[model samples]
Target chain A: MSIPGIRDRKIEDVGLQAGVDRLTEDQIQKTIKKVLKGETGAKLKLYAETCMRCGLCAEGCHYYMSHDKDPSYAPVSKVRQTMWEILRHNGKVSPEFIYGCAQIAYTECNMCKRCAHYCPLGIDIGYIISVVRRICHKLGVVPLYIQDTAHSHSATMNQMWVKDDEWPDALQWQEDEARDEIPNLRIPLEVEGADIFYSVIGPEPKFRTQLIYQAAVLMNETGQSWTMPATPGWDNSDMAMYTGDYEVMGRIKRAHFDTAMRLKVKRIVMGECGHAFRSIYDMGNRWLGWKMHPVRVMHAIEFYHELLEKGQLKIAKTFDTPVTLHDPCNIIRGRGLMDQAREVVKAFCPNFVEMTPNREHNYCCCAGGGVINCGPPFKNVRVEGNKVKAEQLIRTGVPVVIAPCHNCHGGLEDIIHAYKTGQELKFLIDIIYECMEKPDAVE
Target chain B: MNAAYEFVVGPLAWIAGAIFVLGSIYRLVSMYALAVKKDYSSLPYMDLKYSLRSIIHWLNPFGTAGWKASPWTAAVTFIFHICLIITPLFLLGHAVLLETFHGIEWPTISDGLADGLTMLVIAGCIFFIIRRATVDKLKYITSGMDWFVIFLVLATFLTGFAAYHQWLNYQFILILHILAGEAMLASIPFTRLSHMIFWVFIRGYMGSEFGKVRHAKDW
Candidate 1:
């Protein structure tokens, strides 16, 4: 059965056209059986048995609420279609069923775990959907684009596949841009024993090179000792973690941590990305058998919080434009940085108005959980599924929306365009860069 | 006592109690035995005081943060859980039975209070049944097992109410009440009613993980 609401957009855009063509029925069954029987344990059994199917969790799901209360979009329904089906069928489900499971688990649900908060039983539906993704990944039937990104992590140790030479070149280019202002600024490369090793996602170099320049100017103005590795591990983003490619996820996280260890930095401070922070601190590190990161890892929000609290960075002027904050699920809900994020935003923007449901209770931007990585074939679903978020943003009546996470930036951009909300989206750093008083300017 | 009454409230009662105790223990042990992945990330903050506080915060349906999300459902469900527990443990009839069985008696609510509590439980069950039957989202996820448990609780309460007022054949209704109550007990560890035992572990884990590891106020 064809997935409902999937437009005729290019499957090639998602990287699924080539990778999923060779999947056979026998392979699908065997892989599903192997994963469910081998990977799962009593926790899965307990959740399946304990859920009362009360559907009070329906309110917690943005997809279900946005889709006019469509039952299929409910968190439990997502699991019922995927993991519950696998268990009921004893993993002998047909390829068509697997195809549907892939779409529901990957494209339909964001795996944000918001519903788990509403769940009286506290069944982590996100974990259950991820188990389905793992089964699909083992069967080699993942969506095109995300799987391609996973393959990129496997082959290049970074999602963007930035060549070894290109990595340093990008850093040098950013350094040149920062030098134009400071005249003595340097994007410290591989500086051993640095106080901080700054990492960013792949898109930082690929598309948003100016963010690097902005971060460099901030680092230089603060007079903090920091280094950016001109190597494979500089990109902390891991799409493989979302694709259920544990081996690749483990390798990516190991490379990230090992790079920090190599630089001998006291800590690793990552840029404004939610999933990457979750990857290193919550998911990937544990998968690699480290209960915690060997070096302390802090999101840019926390780093900025410390800076402002310590009088390291001063606000020249608060942004006068009415603005609102969009909390990324990984950072706000997955981690507990909502207050710190708000503190940082409040420092720069005086006209800060909160979205109706702010902080940990905020709706996901629909681009997360690798949903945006599924690419254009699923774009309509992503936009329509997050219509509630778009409405929330529109209701805020703020001229600008501050989205701290990269995926939220991308996802909200789409929602603004699709909904014609005429709202501008900005990263917290963008506003900080615009409003902060540079120390060098004092001279 | 008649043969049927003797059988229903005697050996069957002992068997039901045994199953309730052993079954609960077995399920709890099996669940606790499952290996939870250790959180390796060094906590930025740890507050055991707040973790314990979160349990009370979340359990309060009217005052908790989650209450705002689904006020009606939370209110109804909260009342149902309270009545379900209190009516069974502190009701005058159940206390009398306990005294007769083990020669031990605890404080019991007045007969009027017991009747009122039983009425509330029955009303709560009816509200849930209508919700499961009518609400679009709830109807989609509602399973036969869910309805079965609701009706089972309803039957236990309805029969107990009838036996209390002597509205029906007293011995027969009493026997049915004992059977229904016992069946509900036996099903608790195996069915969705297992939440009765697992809620502590699940909510506690969420509290500690969110409160201590993430240093976030979940409530």
Candidate 2:
């Protein structure tokens, strides 16, 4: 699925190409050998040897479905093209092969883990692809945009490379905007012993500042005790884990957990971003070898569900527009929040029509797993690759799609625009903020 | 020709059995040790409750949505595995041989039933081979080794059937049958056939990761 007249077709990752070119043959060989032998354990051995390659997983992949059943996009075939090739050559593959591996592992597959559900033996192709990413990363071969985001995590302790002072400035802007509405709402900052430590991805400050305003409004209206850190550790979005830079991923997680621990908050409430939730709750903490995170954390979906279930945030009027919920893989499949997401959506927007194959079986946005973060070079493929998802949207026939994850919002927005599906994308918090009643008089 | 037949049925069978048992043991122990030493995270959250639930769902035919979605593949796979295990264990010839060698006795399927099941195994292999070859989506993953494995199983069951029916060259087919069965046995620990043993690790650990770690039902 290439756009015509574009030379930058076929997943042209210049950074990956450059990195592969800079590597000596010996470096590539040794790096692959070292990673394959040292890092992977029985998990890799079990998955590799146990796979029978029945191709049952092809039906589960949006890429395969959208591309007219191309065998190359099958989850196991992606592994064959990468891991099997490395094993076949005993780590002596050419630079061009490594570049191809990086493209397929990093961009083509979303790593959403949906196919794992389809696999009869539950072989995690996502794990194998990540292992390939780990190998490419060690060889300094990675997609340009995602690698740059990981670098930002290293330098700024944030994915967007938001400047130090600008972080709080954005919050101040939101707090003031919210106060104009509430007359007394102040986004609490650095509140010690607060019940909740609210954090968001850097995008809120960089571009989507209105999300911060909406979240602030929700917090005030609910009469919740919450604080946003006026510091670098506030941003929870992570690209390091996606890029297979676990060392940087661990550092970012530490900063986030440490910030919450320092504030003595009872829990950390992250904004609507699926990868950020995954990094903090599932992957980053696991890499740090923490049996449990120092502070309890929940995604915005869980938070909104909790608030709505307890009648803490009451609705003034049910949403008028018909809407469908897009279950982000990290939360629905990775965390089993499918029921809660549906409950929250149905409560506010009663005109809910579920897309076919909803819940854990839903197709990925094709932009997640850092494909969207890979930026404009991959945008065409990202949209075209998930025509199945666009069709899913069209099937729902809803004017709006509510995705509880920021990355899904970004991903779905692009598809809607490109496909001309004419569906507006909104966060769950956005819809709730609109329909939920604010206090009649400010405190 | 007598020497070759005796070698396959006697010494080769013994060698294959020893390797099958010992190699399988070695693989399991090494894999368990590796998990303990390197992948400690995989061990901690393996809740028996979730793991067993996940395993039970996968163990049942049409237990998962994916299995239910593609009924033909699931049916073929389940029947193939069932026949592969049941035919060899319950065949009257195998039971008598075990009783003579190890002084043990167990009820076996009648000769006619074993013949039918053996044909089913061969038919299953043929079905898989044809599916892999003709199905466009399976082309990328259908390796030379996949063909070799399917051919190995087909040859085992095919020759067993021929020797039973006393078809052309009965003595030669009998020898071929013994050798192919033994090759499949020795391959159990070294090749993808090892999946028979490690499904607990791949499917079970995945079950645990999804059910216990991620709190989602993998199946």
Candidate 3:
């Protein structure tokens, strides 16, 4: 029932102790209390008291079903570990308990909020867990690797430590690279008042710069009025979502919005990222006390759908494969965009297999909500824990898995690789790039 | 020892003690059986890693991790719960009843701890109510059931304190407080308070699931 490639490496054994050197119990307690007293703490209190324990959330959770019908792995149990225990004990539990709470709050759960979809009562266990993370961040119990990313986010406004001077250079690099495939391709940087404010996570600049290159080629072919940011706010990836550091999470979001506002763009068009979308819409913006976002946000899938539907982008060829889509919890469950993503998929791929309980009910990639970002020590558990997801994919027997969110893409890469399911994970744009009928071919 | 002639004391004592024991046993039995049927699994080894992280988590209790998760909310909410728990079992009335019935007069906390725990319960309830009102994300999630639970707790705490302090001679307040206490205990087997007994198992189960994912036993 498990994937062969999944390694049993324990994240704790992998130098997590190095991050443990600086922290002390008193400092962690102080940090935990501070976060609880802040806006995030208040949110946790509200979510905890509201859950009626209806167990409707069971079906929405992959872990719950993945473990052969264990009711405890249900998403609600995830909240119970952190919030309910804190509620029952009056904050007097030992540090060992807090550690368990930290892992459950941050790594084990993906904060996809799909369970909220299944709940008639609309209980958001993901929000409850994020609040737990907010508390954990304050306590300094966060895994060191993930914490470093947050530090990078705070310092560079990107998670991957991409240097300031390197951003525009990278964009130029991608544009130059893209010209090999499309001679007229360009990656527009800092074009004020452009119709689209194109944003991406630090991974784009750091590791998968080719995605940027691909986007540039697509944008060039479509002649889209897109602009990339030259400044610190260019990164749409918010590590605050993972750290549970709501205050920092809020600041990052405000920075992102202010950056967009300064540019006077109509709306932000983000690359494939689920958690970033959630941070902007669900966790961060709400922490800032806004009922709704003033500036609109669009996922890459929805944005591509608009472009294709409006004749802004043209297809080169129909992707001929039995490709299954892994709905990023942020986009599908958090934002309710299952149909649009499917529509975009149908337009490109000739054969699409829908996973059971597809769309908004899709399971998290086990890498989101900062879980994958939590570091390599906990990687084995994350991979092993996603047996249900692997099974879901295996049952579908699809050769390709398209995950539009960056975290999902990263996490899925690990999951698919670990399971050795021979499944190729991809961003929807990759398919669009391959399947879109060339302009010359159409002529 | 002189129980044969004293009908009210001996027979009623036996009845109350029996109900207390049998009812609690029944509740525990039913919960355990339900849990067994549902197959509440054990935590895996990865949970141990999480537990190990607690060494560092406890290092900075004031930071986010220490205070963010359950036991904190549970701590406050349960402070109220613990007060409700201790007060009912060790109150002057309960002491007198137990002395007459079960023949056990438990040593009590200082009057200060008693009153402090009560005030603590009140503060916890107030904190919960205010949080529901103020936080926008929380406000959307709050239900009428939540409000009812809050108000019910306030009534129980306020009335019990009033009776305990002798500020209310209105047998009404004392009687209502007693009824609420009894009702709450009975409801424990059915309502959300059941989470008190079940969350440990649930959390342990959740903790273990990660191990299966990690390909190790739960921490």
TM-score attained by model 1: 0.94
**What is every candidate's C-alpha DockQ against the true complex, given to 2 decimals?**
0.42, 0.73, 0.03
Candidate 2 lDDT, A1-443, residue by residue in tens: 11111213356678887898898778889999899888888888788777888988888898888888777777887888888878778888878778878888888888999898778877889989999999989989998999999999999999888999999888888888777788888889999999999999988899999988888888888989999888889989889998889899999999999999999999999888899988888888888888766689898889999998888989988987999988899988888899998998888887999998888888899988998988888788788889999999999998999888888888889899888999998888888888889994263
TM-score of chain B of 1: 0.90
Clashing pairs in 1: A14-A144, A14-A145, A15-A144, A15-A145, A16-A144, A291-B40, A291-B41, A292-B40, A292-B41
lDDT rank order: 2, 1, 3
Worst lDDT 10-window in candidate 2 chain A: A1-10
Model 1 segments beyond 4 Å from truth?
A1-29, A441-443, B36-51
Winner on lDDT (2 vs 3): 2
Better candidate number, 2 or 3, judged by DockQ = 2
TM-score of chain B of 2: 0.95
For A180-244, candidate 3 gives per-residue lDDT tens digits of 66766667777889888888888988888878877776777777888888888888888866786
Would candidate 2 be rated incorrect, acceptable, medium or high by CAPRI criteria? medium
lDDT of each prediction vs. the true structure?
0.82, 0.86, 0.66
